[model samples]
Target: MDPVYHIPALLNETIQGLAIKPDGVYVDVTFGGGGHSRAILTQMSAAGRNGSGKLYSFDQDADSLRNKIDDNRWHFVHSNFRYLSQWMDYYGEQQIDGLLADLGVSFHHFDEAERGFSFRFDGPLDMRMNQQAGRTAAEIVNTYDEEALARVLYIYGELKNSRAIARKLISARQQRPIDTTGRLAELLSGQKKELTCVFQALRIEVNDELGALREMLVTARDLLRPGGRIAILTYHSLEDRIVKNFLRAGNIEGTIEKDFYGNILTPFRLIEKGLSAGEEEVNRNPRARSAKLRVAEKIG
Candidate 1:
């Protein structure tokens, strides 16, 4: 199998954010295309003058297994990053030195038509990142109640006309199931924003992306040793906001509590302000335009 490629957004920035150390343990939660993972491994390799270190990468997508790194210092886990803690424990690692997560969908997901992640393609409306488990997008479009669909669209996609779009989908699906991405996109042809929102909402619902992200963030914070680091790249505002708040508040709900010393009780300290891909990278990869990178360190 050929190497699957994902031009990692802010590659150098993410590596610098992790502050990789020789002989330290690290985890790459996304592992899409393995570009970022490869770079981290290169920095940690014994021949690179860094002490030998171990790196573990997680990706539920079966397609990603094709790019598995065969080095002794690296390990790949075929699971969602939300289970980061569980898997790390299984490997006898209670805490790690650093963690990196590239949130949201990957390039391969959009480029491959049969995956149905992109509205431009004519394929079954299946948007399962872990293709083997869980329901597909088609199921939600065809069976979810209109109100439920509207909620997903409104919350995940941040679309104001979600109710109207849900009504339209309900009416169309009554005659027949919304079986394909093309048909759904066609129904939304006149409204470009509606089309993008509906597809985005359905993908999030199918994958429970936000839920997984919340789980991953809390687990990552718990699994990191004090002074350990985290770098997250989020492709959409919804994911970005969650990452931002989690790092700021130490919890998904964004509640801040203070310790006796009056310091914020957050589990992590912000490393830097929010950042995005520079102009050159955005020009080369348009998708990087929406990427938001946030880095933080586990608090004392």
Candidate 2:
């Protein structure tokens, strides 16, 4: 595994939270650097249940293919995690023992300038996680109407000055297309946080991150066997809130349903509630500071 590709956050905590069953099936939906996936594979025993335990790692980014595992029990699916159910069905897996998703951008993408995931470097404004499909960040910046652009920034980035930023982008593109990361970054000059928000908003828009996340969460809820766990590491509040709500209520809307006894009905029993990394880990890898791991086990 490439250590530089990504340093899995809360690695020990997440693996322990899953409570791996040696003869049970597992899935790693975000196999960025194969760190977590490799860890999961280590816990499974090949001799158990006639060597039936398996792991299916999903990654939409073709770049991740380079880090594929060579283990016979490992299967790499080159597709978005939103298609989790379909792919699981294709593999004849009706129920999974555990599922994991580490939802942060890999260091490789941010460090590589041409990928356009970060504003620290100059490159084309292309932020598609799956480079083969979807509109580039530049296309959204240049083509989205002011209101649409502002909505993306406000909803995804949580930027208070989304309207102003959108207006400025609209005005700037009128002179010439906003095509490169440097040019876009120059136009968005402001407090570092705001600049990060703008770039984050564009990347989320380009990849439909939230929408895909919701779909995958729902599918995972349905596909997990009773007592099976799902562990997710979220980097931002937007995705974190969605995950927290779904795990608590067993639905994306987070509505709690109570029985005649006033007991709440939920498919999952919460295991970890937005647990963050320790200061020691954060000091070692600053990028882990924002990661929150939420784990839940399906109620039998």
Candidate 3:
């Protein structure tokens, strides 16, 4: 396994929450570095059920193919997690015992300057997770109207000065296209926190992270069998809130419904409500600091 690719956050907690069955099916939607997937494989194999257990790992980034598992029981799906239902159907899997999604950007992405996932590095403003397709961060910065850019920053990054940042980005791009991370970083340079938010906003926009996340969450909910578990590790508030609400209400809107008897109706029973990584783990992996783990079990 590539240690630098990604360090799975709350590894033990997520696995424990999953409570893997010996011969049950599982899905790891974000197979970055295969840390969490490997852990799940370990638990599944420890039961000594031979090859009865099956694990399907999904990743859109072709780069993740480098960390693929060799076990016969482990199948790697080279597709976005949003297509979870489609791929599961293709594989003839109707239900899953558990699903795990770690939404943090891989360490490989941020550390590799050429990926343009971090403002700390000077590179082209290309932040697409799937390098083969989709709009680049440079395109958004160069083409988006001020209001659209500001909306992305405000909604995705929660930047309070989104309008001002968008205006500045527009002005800077007018002089010359903001085609590289260094130029965009220089134009938007400010407090470390704001810079982080700006880059985060752009990356989210480039990848449509929130939209894909919502789609995956819904598919995961439907794919889980009764008593099956779904564990998600979200790095930012926007995605975290969506996970929290979806798990709580068993729907994306988070609207609680009641039966005629006045009992609230939801398809899931929340197991872990925004559990953060422990201090020991955070000390070893600072990226785990922002991670919040949420687990829920499907109710019959």
Candidate 4:
């Protein structure tokens, strides 16, 4: 099956908010399923761009390239977005007109049980976005010390039962290696609803997702031309919190302040407040229920 990601109705709104210029450049840092990328391409080429405009798309997952559409205007960088600045330098582009990061997991990953991104499936516990990357979720769960495992669960999963889960996992693995996603899930069966939390934590740790995201945000801020806008769509509190604080205060923490004259101090000026999916859209795609879209402009 083709990956079934829920396209947010706010796609047009967020793209429009970017105020795309016909001849200007843009970046889609996460080109999952090419949904948002397709929308951005349409708007960029609406006036017959003739491939003059550029869209630098990034995705570490090679599977993503399989869905890549042929277009001169778009250049897919088969690397992590954490290397955003380096890639732009390689392309000889100094700044961009806008950036869009829809930080959602592709339905392709979840649906492909073999990839092991979902607890619903019984595949090997491999959640590496790029299979070529070292270490899988199974390795982390079965190898990390109890304290470290607890930290991953607590910090990434936000699971109140993190300690319990970690203890259980460590104990269960002593009998036999927790090799498969199903085995791990079964080992923590008491978690039930919290199973999602455990899997999410493992995926985050295995991928170093938050660290990569932080790097991307900083690089994106530096990459934006003066007045360029960025739209970020996040699915969880951890990611949303980072995006929220970064956009509003230009820091991961909300401690940054305006100067004495009440002028804002952030590198990014808020274009609008946070946005969530409307009822109709959420009903259509339950996956969008937790999405939060935030847009900001780089102030010179």
Q: Rate the local accuracy (lDDT) of all candidates.
A: 0.88, 0.92, 0.91, 0.84
Candidate 4: 10-residue stretch with minimal lDDT: 1-10
* Best first by TM-score, ranked: 2, 3, 1, 4
Compute the lDDT of residue 144 as modeled in candidate 4. 95
User: What is candidate 4's local distance difference test score?
Assistant: 0.84
- The per-candidate count of clashes, in order, stands at 0, 0, 0, 0
Model 1 per-residue lDDT tens digits across residues 33-117? 8999999988786555334688999999988887888788888999988888889889999989999998877889998889998
Clash-forming residue pairs, model 4? none
Model 2 TM-score is 0.97
RMSD of 3: 1.5
lDDT of 4 by residue, 1-300 (tens): 555643544677688788888778999998877888888888878657465788888888998888787877888989888899888999999989999988857778888899998878889889988899879998998899999999999999998878888898899999998988888877876456788888888888888888888998988888898989999988889988899989988866666888999987889888867788889877887777787789999988
Task: Give all TM-scores, in the order shown.
Answer: 0.95, 0.97, 0.97, 0.95
The regions of model 3 sitting more than 4 angstroms off are 1-3, 47-50
Candidate 4, residue 55: lDDT? 87
